[model samples]
Target chain A: MPEAFLILILFQLVGSALQTVLHLPVPGPVIGMFLLAAALLWKRSRTRTDKPASSFDSPALSSLSRSLIACLGLLFVPAGVGLVTQMPVLLANGLPIAVALFGSTLLGLMVTAFVMHKATRDRPSPERIPDTGGQVL
Target chain B: MQSLSHTLHQIYARFLPEPNMETLFWLSVTLAVFALGVRLQIRLGRAPWANPVLFAIAFVALGLLITETPYGTYFQSVKIINFLLGPATVALAIPLADSIRLVTRSLPAMTLALLAGSITSVVSGVLLVLLLGGSHDVALSMAPKAVTTPIAIAITTQIGGIPALTAAFAILGGIIAAMIGETTLRRLGITDWRAHGLAAGIAGSGIAAAQVAQRDPVGAAFAALGIGLNGLVTAIIVPLILYFLPG
Candidate 1:
């Protein structure tokens, strides 16, 4: 677990360095995510014949990643609490902020779902087909 | 009873004056409150409105208020957890890679949906804020409200938005999505789990994705994909759009 954490932190550090050096618009951790994904894909392809094809074949790394991602919600609590200090800004633009957040979220949800549903309606993907199999009640 | 109370208070006062002990106290309090929230959320069966983060924040905020702890002091004490967010975000690559491999066939449709949803989220949020006479900072912060918190913070800072405000708005947007996202999709006659999960991920991010994961593993996988892809897409396009905007 410690080794896995070290790897993640190293990737993040490298990503942050790259962002600073290259002036990338994206965040360092996000770039780290892409880099880690690319690394996993590369590692899988290289070891394909000798091992199983699962990208998450390493137990330590896989479990650690799963736990971290699972608690992604908890990770935001500290920052969200910072909102307490921004109470004045929030109060000043209360109506617009409220409307904009709720309205845009709903609109974004509908547009994504509608477009995805319509685009894939004619040809249901194989993975989604099984989801309906157990729901035939 | 009076002497015992005085003795306990003396111990606390002496121990808390040590910087390390104070840090430890606040850190433990943060985790304990969040754990209580998780328990309450489970007790409530993970209902949309029973969001653990929301509960935990409210509790912690109340604690701070009662104790009169400055936000900066509390933030400094809990900086370790905040630091972990970076590595945790990098850990998202595991599920993201797995989901990409699983949903290759639906990649095209998923990509299109992500693009449409992300663009709409940014444009609608900024436009609505401006239409309602919000300041430039508020509007810029609103641009990345749909992205995940860490990325949203970075994007907001990049585009001259207030990172703290963006973080707050992003989480609020996520909670709102978790509360009404499924019902809204169903009302619109969209029943496909993929679409449901994708929307939850794009707009609601982790909170909504966690909600979708309760009954649908496949949908959850897509939600993970949605989170990562939308993060990338919004990160790219927000700057591009702002750059091309008329000054």
Candidate 2:
């Protein structure tokens, strides 16, 4: 578990280094997420014939990541508590903030769902999709 | 009585010094409250309003108020948990990698949905704030509220918004979506779990994604993809929009 955590932190550090070097707008951990995903996919491609032996594909890493993400909500408490200091701003603009957040979230959800449904609604099932078989490789 | 009071005060001061004891005390309090919240949420059948994060924050804030502890002190003590967010975020790769096949299968539709959803989330949010007479800072903070909290905070900082305000807005937005997301999607006659989960992830983020995961694994995968992709897209587009439009 510790080793898995170290691997995740190592990816995050590399991502931070990349962000600093390239001045990317995205955060380091996000970059780390993309890098790690890409690396996993790449590893899977190379070891398609047999069970992969790489540590990145280890069940330990998988379980560790799952547990961390399961508790992702608890991770936000500290920052969410920071809202206490913004009470004045929140109180002052409570109406606009509330409406905008609620309305826009609802709208975004609808639009995304609508588009995704429209695009895929008419398509045949997964078995018939041409890209389903070997697109990743 | 006076001597006894003085002796108790001295004992309290000696045993619970300012820095070390305070850290342990606040950390314990935060974890305990959150654990209680998780149990309550489970008991409540994982209702949206009983969201553990929301519960923990409200309780902890009240605790801080009653104890006369500043937000800064509580945050400083629990900063270790916040630090783990980075690694947890990086850990998202595991699920994303696991769902790569599903993602690749519907790449075009997913991309289209992601783009439409991401753009709408930013434009609609910022425009609504401005039109509703909110200040520029408030509008900026609302811009990334649809993204997950960590990425939302980073984007808010980049765009000169209040990160704290953005975090609160993002979490609230998530709760709101989780509350209404399913009914809304169902009313729209969208039965596809993939669409449902993607919508949850894009607009509702982790909070909503967790909700989706409760019902369907396939939808959950798409939801994870939604969170990651929306974060990436919004991170790029919001800055670009600000740069080109200067709003």
Candidate 3:
């Protein structure tokens, strides 16, 4: 239905608007995302009848969300093209920047992983959570 | 178009958009740009360094040169794709939701990490510029280079680094992260997949996310989560901190 597409676009519009209007340092789509989540959860919250929660967690809905998730890969195409534009610059800065990038990323990972691994180690593994599932992409 | 001086007039004339052909022609280039990207990914071995984004960009620049289209003219339409990038970035929230609990629990450490990451890049960027005698805006833009593009762009915009330039630098950071971040992590003996992925996301954004996913989905997913959260976190924190910091 047009409503679904509109919902998606509407979220984006609101997100963009917030970026331009409020100057939220946070990305507008992110704002729009929370807004959309609120709406979805709100709609989800209202249906408290004997009607099972099945509709809320419908396979159809999950499939749609899954595709949107998949489109995350598609979104890279444009940026990737943009990447090619900077090849000359990249080549020039390649060695030093590579050092910085890899070094920083490694350092960031060590710190995050160290803290997280320790924190989650004692807790029941995420696998125990019903919907936590297998953490596969 | 064959005549040298006439080519200039022809380009200017095309700018006027006299007929439907010109519009269609530009549309074709845009589509080709997207197609070339997909095609290269499928056709090649799909090596990380030989990424689709890199290929499309090279093709587009070469195409522009061959067609003799001015970079400005080509950008007129490509800008549409650029504009859509904002919403695509916002779409990252989908993945972010999956990690909300983890983020909430670890907010302090995560914030500390993000702040550290931002400071590392900003100080280095500005220092590099000052040391090299680059423009102040370049220094300002480079500050957020470690963060993903959208947040990086906003921070750059606020501090007056050219957004496009910042976008380029952010991608460079991601590529470098993708290329060898793993090696460093291995050398450091950080063996947890989740931590590695988180690091990849923090430093590399989506590119690193995809790279990490290729090796380990759990780590990749976490990386994606980190990318979104850090993008948001840095977007907010960097601007506020930069506001008080001596520029």
Candidate 4:
């Protein structure tokens, strides 16, 4: 159980370290998750070919996975509590703060949309009507 | 004598000087708090403005009050949550990576858009605050209101804004952005999940994705990407901007 826990965190650490170093637009956690998934996939593949004609796989990892899934939401508690400790500051700066936040979302949406549209402009939309052969050129 | 004894019990309960538990203690408490967060969401679906983070805040306070636990005792155990947060935050990279094809294809537009989004958010916030004659601290914090917590706090501190104040405002900003996001996107005629998610991630961070996940999982996934990547960008860019912005 402890081994699995350590493995889970180690991949996350690697992902973050890489993100910091590479300056990828991608987040570290996403990378870590991918790495973890890759590792798990690799392990599964390895076990499939080794003494697996009639061997049963380990149940411990499944239980551990279930525990982690169950505890997922709890991870945000500290930051959430940190919010309460800072309320006085919030009430004082509410309006301008609101403007900044809402405004940013709008701006980001516009820019991201423009970017996405431009990127995929050449690729036909999936919703486009297809020809007889199901091709939508 | 009986009444006096009862009063003494109350006093003892309220003012006990002690640390109840260590790291494991706090981690479990945090997990339980998050469980309550899930409960709050389930109880208040449809008009789903109920934020888990907000519930978490209330939960900790209530726990402290009911258990007669001191802040120090709670914090000692709570540090585990903080420690794990760093890794959990790093884990966000997984969702972000899933969008690599979109990212490489749209690099220029995304770059320009990120630059525009970051600058505009800061500029507009500052301008509005100046127009309102808000305090220097208030104005400073508002500048980074759209960014992630780490970047927001840095910008706030550098520009002579209060760091703590910036964090709180960031949360408020995230909640507000998450709230109006879907309706605003539809009204703007923007149907792309990538775009919507990008916007939510940049402006709302994790809080926004949590909300986005309910209505659109794909968008939420992309939003997670946008949050982590752009958070890193904002962290680096905003601080540098402050560094060279004439003081």
Candidate 5:
């Protein structure tokens, strides 16, 4: 568990380094996510011919990630707890914010779904889409 | 019972002399409350809107209020939880990696959909807020309402919005999506599980993804994809979008 966590934190550190050096607008954790994904892809490809290979595919990493994400709801509670202090602000601007949030969320959901459905109409199911495995090799 | 209370008060008073020890108290309180909230959610059959986070927040907030503990004090003690957000955010890549094949295969279509969805979320949110006479900060915060709370909070910070408010709005978005996202998609004739999950996950983030997970694994996978990609895209583009907006 500790090792898996270290890997994640290391990825985050690298991401933060890139963000700080490049002055990117994106968050470090997001860049870290991309980096981690890239690393996993690289590992998966390298170990494809080998039998039961690559630590990237290890159950520890997968389980650790799952547990971390499972508790993700709880992780956000501290910030949500801060909401008590903002009740006044929420109450004051509640009407407008509510309208905007409700309207935009609905619109975004509808348009995104429509676009994806249209785009994938002629394609295979998303689950069956094959990986671009050999392209990098 | 009286002796139990006396012992608890004694233990609390022992920590009173040390500032650092108070961290333990608050952390314990948070975890205990949050765990109970989760148990309640489970017992309630995990209703879409019976959000555990909402319950925990309300519990902690009310606990602080009734005990007359300041928000800052409670937050300082539970800062450890906040720090975990970074690792949690990084962990999001796990699901993304799992779905990377699907994403790579449908890269163009998915990219287009995400870009359109992300831009629509920010633009419509900002415009609505401005049109409704909300402050500039509110507009900026609301712009990232389509993504998850962590990413949304970060985007809000970068775009000069209030992070706390942005977090609240993100949760609100999730609850709303959990309630009506599937129904709305069905009404629109979008029966595809992937499309339904993507819409809900994109608009509502992790909470909506969890809700989708309860019904269908494929839909949940798509929702997870939506959460990761929408968060990444929104984080990258929201600042630029906000910069160009009139607000």
Candidate 6:
């Protein structure tokens, strides 16, 4: 578990480094996610025959990941507390901020759902969709 | 009676003394408070608006304010909790990987949905802020309200907004999104799990995703995909919008 955790942190650090070097707009951890996924895919491709399957499926990693996901809500607590500090600003501009936020979110949701439903409404099921590259699911 | 009263006062002073700036003690208190918040949320059947994170923040914030503790001082310990956000976000890859099969099958549609949703979120947020007389800093912060907290903070800072304000708006926007999402989607006749989940994730982030996760894993999977992809899309587009549009 410790080793797997270390690996995750290492990837995040590498991601952070990359973000700093390239000045990418995306967050470090996000880049790390893609890096991890790509690494897993690469490992699967490299040792297709005899590598005792993928290490990403390890129990330790799974458990750590599950725990992290489960307690995900807690991780936002500190920054959420920033609201108290920003209370004055919010109070002064509360009306407009609230209007814009809720309004845009609703608009975004509608546009996304409508566009997605329309675009994929005609596509066949996952099983029937012909595989062109890597495994679909 | 006087001796007993004096003893009680001493005990109260000693036992309930001010929660000093001790790192370990405050750390434990923060975790315990959040754990209690989570338990209450679960007990209340995971009410949409009674979000645990919100409760935790209110509880912690009120405690700090009443105690006259400086936000900066208290953050020394809480920063550890904040740091873990990166690892937790990185851990999101597990679910993203799990859903890759479905994602790859409908790659074009999913990408289109993400782009469309992300663009709408940014354009609408920024435009509304400007139209409603918000400052440029507020506009920059509001632009990333749809993204998750960590990424939203980074984006807001990069675009010269108040990072703390962006953090607050991110959670506020997410909760508000979760509150109105279901009724709005149903009214629009969006019954498909994939479409509904994608909308929730794109607009609401983690809180909305959790709500979807309770009812349908497939929906949750798509929502997770939306969360990650939307984060990436917003990160790219917000800067461009700021540069080109300059609103």
Best by TM-score: 2
Residue B205 in model 5: shift from native, Å?
A: 0.5
Which 10 consecutive residues of model 2 chain B have the lowest summed lDDT? B4-13
Q: What is the lDDT, from 0 to 100, of the residue A68 in candidate 6?
A: 83
Query: A122 in model 1: Cα distance from truth in Å?
Result: 5.0
Chain A TM-score values, per prediction: 0.82, 0.85, 0.73, 0.52, 0.84, 0.80
Better-scoring candidate (TM-score), 2 or 6: 2
**Model 4: docking quality category:** incorrect
For model 6, state the Cα shift of residue A1 in Å.
Answer: 0.7
lDDT of each: 0.84, 0.86, 0.60, 0.59, 0.81, 0.79
Q: lDDT tens string, model 4, B1-247?
A: 5576566547645664344634555566666676676676666752346766566767776665555555666666676655564455433433444456666765676676666666666666666676655656676667677765644553455557766566666666777777887677778776766666667777676566556655555565567666666665665566565554432
lDDT of 2 at B241: 71
lDDT of 4 at B66: 55
User: Could you tell me the lDDT of residue B49 within candidate 5?
Assistant: 74
Best by DockQ: 1
List candidate 4 stretches off by more than 4 Å. A1-76, A83-88, A114-137, B1-18, B21-30, B62-73, B148-163, B244-247
Output the lDDT of residue A60, model 1. Answer: 82
Candidate 6 residue-wise lDDT, B1-247, digit = tens: 5576566546544665554535665577789888897778667866787777888888888667555567887787678888988887777777787677888878898889899999999999889888888777788889998887777887887888887788877787888878888788889877777887898889988888777777666677888888888988999999988787754
Better of 3 and 5 by TM-score: 5
lDDT tens digits by residue: candidate 5, A1-137: 67788989999999999999999888898899889988887787777565885655577888888887888888888888878877887888877899998999898888888898888845434443233321100
Candidate 2 wrong stretches, greater than 4 Å: A121-137, B1-15
By DockQ thresholds, what CAPRI class is model 5? Answer: acceptable
Between candidates 2 and 6, the DockQ winner: 2
Task: Summarize candidate 3's per-residue lDDT along A10-88 as a digit string, tens digits.
Answer: 7878987977897676666667766665555566567665776544334444444555544443333334444444556
Model 3 CA lDDT for position A1 = 31
Which pairs of residues have clashing backbones in candidate 5? none
lDDT of 3 by residue, B59-136 (tens): 666666556666666665555565655555544554555456556665665566555554555555555554555545
After best superposition, candidate 1 residue A86: deviation in angstroms?
0.3
